[model samples]
Target chain A: MTPASLDLRPLFPAIVVAVTGLAVLLAQAFTPKGGRAPAAALSLAGLAGALVAVVVIAGGRGRGAVLATSVAADDFALFFQALILAIGIVAVLLSTSYLRETATDRGEYYALVLFAIVGMLGLVSALELVAVFVALEIMSVAVYALAGLQRDRPESQEAALKYFITGSFSSAFFLYGVALLYGLTGRTSLALIAQGLRAGGIAPAAAAAGVASAGAATALALVATALLLVGFGFKVASVPFHMWAPDAYEGAPTTVTALMAAGVKAAAFGAFLRVFLQALPSLAAHWQPAVAVLAIVTMIIGNLGALAQSNLKRMLAYSSVAHAGYLMTALVAAPGLGTEAILFYLVTYAAVNLGGFGAFAALTRSGREPVTLSDMAGLSERRPLLAAALTVFLVSLTGVPVSGGFVGKFYLFSAAVRAGYAHLAIIGMLMSVVSAYYYLRVVVAMYMEPPVGEDPWSRVGTGAALALTISTTVVLVLGVYPGPLMAWARAAAGSLR
Target chain B: MALFQAILCYVFGALALGAALVMVAQRNPTYSAFALIVTLVSLSAVFGLFGAPFIAALQIIVYAGAIMVLFLFVLMLLNVRTEVRAPGEGRVFKLVAIGLGALLVGEIGSVLVAARPALAGGFDASARQVARLLFDARYLYVFEATSILILASLVGAIALAKRDPSS
Candidate 1:
């Protein structure tokens, strides 16, 4: 076959997920406990296959094409595809031990996880409004079920309920925004929408109408932007729209939380980057100030709210919100940073956050959930390696040296500074300082306090431990030498225009 | 044909908006579920008006007829209506949410005004015309992508609805 004909490889990542999803379902039906190992192995193999496919497709630039106007199977898609697959793999690894301990281990559990990964990959790659919405629904539905996967726990049902209610609400907003934007541009394609806006042939009479009738095309555009932002804000747990996150995160299984923090956050940001940066660039003047305000509120509210939280998951939920603010700052400054900074921050954020959650996942006792800060006391003494891994993750979250979080924050702040939003950068820096206190406090609890009755160290699994170690190692390595990552991020971001 | 199309779009859009308003305003969870069904149905019609006949049909068949029914069935199965008699959250928060809603509406209105100039000829033709446009060589990729999304959704739904084996 010619090289062009041979280049059917890049599309395998999506196909791999589909195939694995089916295999997992089959395993659930036909496989026994001893056979369960094969399901896990198959999932890992599939995820690895997808990740390698992404790398190959990304390497063979210009070989990938948009499946239609609705999906771009290019470097940008591959970058996010790789992130989603990695997060999925880590989640699967973390859950193996947790599930085995609870006797909740089943083939369907892995299958559901594969399905969730399929949704996430679909979300990252989709380019059209309907496509994104469908992908999001698929992802949300699977996760809602996953949240309640622990059927024995009432909290799991509660978390699933709350998430479903809020998620449906957000979906409504997303759909409405899609409708409004379609009304405004008559096309669902972001590129076409942008082109139409740039052409700027709107009649002036439309501007003279009342607030509802403001017939001003910009009014509809602003409404659409606000609606879309609300939907994404809920997903990323930005302040004012983040009330559901803490409760949901606390109630859900730890492995699922890792997926939420890493896969969902990355996918949401991916969609946000694609929609706003590609379609609404011309409306920057209208939306920038609003985003700046949101960034500040999210940062302040997230950090301060986390202060009173005794629940570790809840605190981390709030911290995730705070981080969303920092990422939003990067997004707001996208005009100045040229998109590279936002993409880089997402990658680093995924590594560090997933690492922290994975570490937490390993420390759980059978039939006992990890919720309280006090529950983790003296962890450094009992399980030094896991503690060290968690510490590294926490430090990375606090933007400490030699961690991916540090590099991500540095790029975000620098991007804002370069964008001449010096004030926003300063605010972001101050919030990071506030954030450091909570992350460090976790470290203090681990090292300084007496052990809680019995050490939970022996319960940690090799797979989960491996995930944490690899995540922490990647975070540190990326922090110290980010040139290679920065180059790819720049290339992907440049392709947006 | 133009007048009929305009009327159809308006009726569907209005019905959808009205149902959404009822869903938000209704205090009873059961009533809210009923309103949601109406809203979903209206939205499906709105999709039809936009010329996406297949998607519109799917919206009704899947979202309104099946998904909403499933949601209602779940809600009933939980039998939570009596347990959650009180408002779900604090009154002050609700008020603030309403205020934010107003501001959001105003902002969206402003954006609509700004964007109106470029909307000319955006919807000059019906959904069938658009579908024809979609099948053309240049637009073929999107058709395939949409199919993939549908397939993924099917898999996802099955995965989610499957029972816990350990139970």
Candidate 2:
């Protein structure tokens, strides 16, 4: 509570995001017509600087710092901060061409994206329930608006509306859970709650308070847990709670969708891991079953759901949902391996999704949305490099050899197996197989189908193409040699507070 | 019989449940949104009766005040007047929504009832204690989070309202 005790170093990443966001806004204000490129460059530069700052501050292997009970700057936070910043960088790169083509190339677009990333970083680092809720709102509201940034596009508006309603409802559920939790434990900090729960049986005086004390506090805790689960489930787009994902993904600009699937989901998973693993560990036996069921349902539903989608973005959305299920399986199989598995899967998933979406962004021509599977036909014949890159991305998503997704899934299933949930792993793997069917379907259309008239791949900028190429290469590199990353993941997961 | 206290609890709980039901079944979204606000406010009152006065006040202030206003403004702006015209009309989807809604309600209900044993004596001077804790200890974080929320809102509002430059 002392001002001297407030270690501001832990807040550097968040401050960097905020300052960079402001810089982007100011640059947007000063920039003239046709100056979107410079604005985007500046935003990208700011994000890169923030990324560097986060690394430099949190780069050491130790727990960097803690800002009272509100935030922590440990390996877990640094990992997510890095992931979010990386996603922001890719989003900026994707948006450069996307905005230029759509003729909605406003400097503010990049600024909003940067601001969303700022929120995302805070969401990951926050250690208090209140702080997490506010960070989530900041992130969600920004993305909701960005989804409909192309206001003239009906689909964009529709995406934004659906996302906004569902998101608000989820926020209410999350806050209600927080309230219930506060009532039950008279606290909100995860660390304090964990300590309270473990101090030899719900406090001595609370026990003497008798029957009402036992039932009410326990009931409130359980309700809070369920609400929190639902809230996070919606954010991660798990099945049975994933209706908004496809519409939002398909309707939003591809870059925004990428940000949602990558940055937002990663942050949500971080919160999910932190809350359940930290505050509710004592109730693991009770909640693990619920999570297990959700995992199975999400995997099956997300994969089957993806089976019929023709739109690439919609398919990827379903794939993202299925991936959440897969990740949830790891979370459910919880002898502590769940945490590490989730961190690993999230890093791999971010790279793969960004790569896939980057490829899509590269294919999109001016005045035309290249979302349909048919629209991507004969890509290999027309734009060989882009087609090959997309193939790598899809193959990686399908868990093929030497791709990050493959290693990611391997880590998850292995973690589940280690937790004595081999059956869950089997079911998850089966769902992965089903997901591969849809992800590969896109690949087949890209290679097998004939070109529909003149290909517009020539219109894609070299920088955009380079981004896709780098993403694809990263996917493969991480897949083949994931040892270092896994080591980092293990350390980060262990540091869960 | 402790008539005043028991009667208050029953009355407030009944109002909360009633408003919640109205919120769920109402055809008009604006009306549904309004019903939701009422439910939230009454829930806050219920929390207040339970001695979590701060939570109750926050419930009314945060959810009912800021959140619902935003919801209602969007509803009015978007003119979501007709239930039938609401997006996602597929029968299967509706069925899923209903099923999920029922499950959520059931789960929460069961949990609440199960944990009912833990409730102790209601609020007795904890309001000032909690407030003091929040301000004296948690003020800086709250300030930071509030600033972030405001900035996000400002950016979001502008983004949502801006006209297309190309148009």
Candidate 3:
């Protein structure tokens, strides 16, 4: 239990981010009212330290488990840790201006965001089910409260309630699945469970007599995967389980929505891919088709749903759902090109999503977000830089050429096609085509339509501007020259054992 | 001693089943809470008969004591009078659920009886074992990390719930 016995260098990134969260709370509590607490700057510094740690430990130290195998620090975890931290940094930057403008600039926002990032960092690395469950809860609870950060607004409260209630139900389903897996395999560690399931026997250290027979284990594994899918499905906001996302996204603060759209989905997908591939690959013949079916329905339904939304946030919510479908398609082809595609696509998706929402959060719209497409009407004539950035994001979302979204979609669909899931790729391509209409409508409104009012648009703030710039640059760089990142993604994706 | 333990197990098991049925069938919320408590206490007794005193104590302390008290207090405080029922809440599904529940109970009972010998051979479930694992195992890190989660949640709850005069 002593620090000397454990090689904790790999866990340093999560520790840095988590400690900074507490520090943010401390600074917030001690600071005098009406005085700046430097919460944003402190979190950014911590995130930078974490990012550097991820790079420094990218070698031999991060390739194994620590803390008695409750969690891992493998290349896969490091890759996602880096991505999650990067997303946090950009999110914090965006939130600085977003909170100040909305008059909800409480210091807890940064601390909560940092905590959520810590959860995500733990989530991708966790090797044990209890750790996964706790990390998931940590991430979920923070976001649940964050969904209601604007306490004065009834919609935010409703969003929080809906999200929390649904989240708890999903967690119950997940825990039940975990219990079943433990009962059947008599192990709690994911790798051990997979070993037990594959060997068709109780794991060596367990009391084998209490465990079910091999035939029964398969049956229980099927049910467990179904239940686990329900849990992960809700988190990723896939179809039939995604009724809450539109409302929550529409009601929550725009920057938080950005993180929800980008970071949460990425983290959940990381866990989903790992759990399925690592712990339940033996059941893939059954689960793969289930995931494929979910992907097909999610892609079709999500695009169709987004077509009906007029509000900017709700549309992105549905679009994120559709993107979840696209990502799930990669799961069907995993342990190979599919894994690489997912790694590449998540970054592109995160960048474009953050860029799109960051552009919206850039301007103070009278203490609230501008909701309708017309809110961006003639935005090229007003904030030209923002208008251009938004256009790029929208274009990227539409998967057009010369954008990150285009390259990501190409890589993902090609991988799906190569993996004999050509049908999924075809359906995904068609839905993405269908998505072009709504996405471009916003772009058209921004560029072609007349201004809505005589009042001048507010200038974009510095922090938000920086956030948007970084996101947009990531999107563009990945679009044009994705060589370096592609190699990194290849290395990370191949490391899963 | 074996005969006595077996008899005790059967008595508490039967009592638990009877109390549970009463809890579900009772119309009054207050009576239902009492019945639930009876069921939980009996269940705890059953656990104690099964040589799991820690779990038995936890069952009584957590579910029967603390949670039931809160349930009763909330029911009394709210002063609820109406029957807690949804109008036309699908009886067919309820019947199906009850039937499936019984089936599951039978299956689990059979499995437990069959696996009693294997389970009896497992390592000690003593408090010392749990404490050692909590500290000696890496679960200590998980325990520590969970605090941050709790603290963050507490902060969030306060931030969202508290009234601000400035606003």
> Whole-model Cα lDDT per candidate?
0.78, 0.82, 0.86
Predicted model with the maximum lDDT: 3
Model 3 Cα shift for residue A281 (angstroms): 2.0
lDDT of 2 by residue, A412-459 (tens): 898888887788899988877877888888889989999987666536
Poorest 10 consecutive residues by lDDT, candidate 3 chain A: A203-212
What's the TM for model 3?
Answer: 0.93
List TM-score (chain A only) for every prediction.
Answer: 0.93, 0.95, 0.97
- Model 1 residue runs over 4 Å out of place are A1-11, A32-37, A61-64, A201-215, A336-338, B1-167
lDDT of 2 by residue, B1-167 (tens): 46886788888889888988998789999999988987898888778777788788889889999999999999999988967665767899889999998999998888677655565566354678776766664657766667877887787788788766656
DockQ, every prediction: 0.18, 0.34, 0.54
The TM-scores that each candidate's chain B achieves against the reference are 0.65, 0.70, 0.82
Model 2, first chain, TM-score of 0.95
- Per-residue C-alpha lDDT of model 1 across residues A1-497, encoded as one tens digit per residue: 22233333434677787788777777666765545546777899889988887877777763456654666776677778887898888887888887766566766667667767777787777767777787787678777777876767887778888998998899999899888777766677888878766656142333333323424577788898999989988888898889888888877787888888888888888888888888888888877888888989998999898887988888888888898999988888885363788788888788877777777777766766666778778888888888888888899889987888888889998988888788888998998888888889999998999887866544678898778877887888888999999988887777676
Candidate topping TM-score: 3
Choose 1 or 3, whichever is better by DockQ. Answer: 3
Error of 2 at A301 (Å): 0.7
TM-score of each: 0.80, 0.82, 0.93
